[model samples]
Target: MDMRKMFGFLFGLMVSLWLGVSLALAQSGYPQPTATTLNDFAHLLNANDAAAITQLLTDLKNEHGIEGTVVILNSIHDYPTGDDTIEAFATHLFNTWGIGDKADHKGVLILLAAQDRKVRIELGTGYENQYNDEMQQIINEHMLPAFKQGDYGRGLYQGTRGVIATLTGIWPPDERPVQSGGGSNSPTPVTTASSSRERSDGRMGILIFGAFVVIVGYLILAHIFGWPVGNSRSDDDDDYHSWSSHSSSSRSSSSSSSSGSSFGGGRSSGGGASGSW
Candidate 1:
């Protein structure tokens, strides 16, 4: 083929491919922010769950003065923001929606793609230091199990709680609460002598009362029934087994829905992790 014809054919092919990709993305149901204030655009959450999550986010902002949102997408196969990893898509979505405080950039986005079986915890520039490890732990430990079991609601709920706890220092990444009574680096101080003495007395009184009650009960039982008590181990085991079966059946029949909203114009430099189940 002549150079002119060949160039024209190549350009046509590129345009056709681009158009095809565009069409696919259009059909992929890429989520659009229905309302800036109303989180859960994808409608992954049911009405009640969505309301609860929105309240939690609002409280987080009110208490800590930080903005955080959760975004759940049906799939990311033809994500509108470009065919990218969940991490990249999350970052783009976070910035596009502008999630956190405009000046401090203190926004956090927890993005979950149900069909893709992926999750991402994308943090704004302001939260990178505080949230990085905690976010990962939340995803790996709390969210993954629920996602694997198709419990998206539980996953999002636990993940959001983890994020909140981490930021507020209520739950450190180590899964331990910060000891309240000490200097920044010092160990929590031992209890005072008077407090310890009171606790000891309290324990002793409880133990003596418990022993007396047990002795009285045993004497009454022995007098009425005349010796050793009958063992109820077999009956207890049967009841436990029945309860376990009922619980297992109930768990298997459960389902969950989730919803989320757009961000507050916060930007990211690709600072988050991604995972799949």
Candidate 2:
């Protein structure tokens, strides 16, 4: 072949390969934010589960004026942020969607990557301090267990409830039996019963105490800054069998309907954490 023709052909081949790779990468990346009504782009959760979660989120917003959403994706390999860490991708999404009220900047995004076995709770600027460590614990303790068990719906539900409970000052149900201590001398029957009750109360007291500490700390900070308690900020994974793909058509149609949804102009400074199960 002539030198000019050879160079042209090589250039064309390179361009074609590059375009193909770019298109594939785009396809693999996270789906664009479409619906404001609980996006399940990866189709991880069933319709019933998705509806329930959506209602929970909506109620949280309506009753508490807190803005939050759950996002489940198949993978983050092609996340537009190009950051290997799920944390970055989540933060980017949180900001991109403006998940919270613009004035309050209070937003929480629960991002779960099923194939990647990763999860993240990304918070807006208002919630950085309030939702960080405790939120991490919730993901590690509540969400990761369900995910590891191949229960994405349960995992997301539990995780969402955990966040709500934390914010609403409610404690999760405890199933552990209470213990009673007694001396070598036999105690009165009433005393024994009371002791057991006291121990049970003590367990609840500890949890309340912990929560009180957080609330008081938050209040003090708020008072010092002349702000209110409504402000706050808001991870993990495991390996197991992958969920079967189903209802793609429904999901796509939902996404299209939700395309009109937009962010509330909220922003984030990379607040929140991430984890894997």
Candidate 3:
């Protein structure tokens, strides 16, 4: 083939490939939320479960003025702009949807990425940072167990209730199960400010001690090797499995439709805990 013809063909092939990839990426972007309370894109929840959760969130908003959003997706990396880290994705979605009241900033996002085996409890900036530990406890004690057992609905429902109970004293209705399992799997009470501070202090102390040990070891090694140790190195650091059991319309008509104005222009500054099951 002539050089000119070969060059033209190659250019066309590259352009076609680029266009195809761009189109695929555009199609894979994270879905915009349709409901204020629950966006079960993975279709994991049953009708009854969805309705119950919706009702709880509605009551929560009415009584406490706190907005809650639950999102379940197949994978965090399935879409463009979706983060591999549940924490990042949850924060982005929380802010993107404005999950809480703009002025009060009382918002909570419960995200379950099924394929990724990760979950996150993202809180709005209105909350204290210590709440992250409580969130972590919830994931560890309430959510992961049921999830590991292949009970996504129960896991999510219980986790949502845990969040509500932590934020507001009101727990879920007695009729519905508050937690998924028994045998020493009960949810832990939210940590007090004093306790959280103590834990933080303890962690800091351990870190300092560890750093000191490392420095001493490095100095000894450097002296023995007769090396110049002038260099310093700084190191800086849901849910789709159950969809086939029911129909989409069934889910939408239940809890999905209940969220009229799902979010309230609230924003989160990446305050939450992430976990894997």
Clashes of each: 21, 8, 6
Model 2 C-alpha lDDT per residue in residues 1-277, reported as the tens digit of each score = 4785666556655655664564454333345565565877665665666777787777777888888889976666534447687887887777766788899888888998776789998888987677789888989998887777677777787788888777767643432222233111121112234334434544554555456445444443333333433433220111111111223443576467656676677878877767897
Top candidate when judged by lDDT against the true structure: 3
lDDT of each candidate versus the true structure: 0.61, 0.65, 0.70
TM-score per candidate, chains pooled: 0.54, 0.57, 0.60
Error (Å) of candidate 1 at residue 156 is 0.3
Off by over 4 Å in 2: 1-30, 170-260
Which run of 10 residues does model 2 get worst, by summed lDDT? 235-244
Residues forming the 10-long window of minimal summed lDDT in candidate 3? 235-244
Candidate 1 lDDT by residue in tens digits, 162-224: 888877876422322222332112112122443344345445645654564454444333333
**Whole-model lDDT for model 3 versus the true structure?**
0.70
Error of 1 at 43 (Å): 3.3
lDDT tens digits by residue: candidate 3, 1-277? 4785666556655655664564443233455566778877666666767877787777888899998988877676655574757777888778777889999888998988776788989999999475899899999998898888777767787898899998997777734544345421222211244334434544564565456445444443333333345543232110122222233444465455546745788989999899996
Best-to-worst order by TM-score is 3, 2, 1
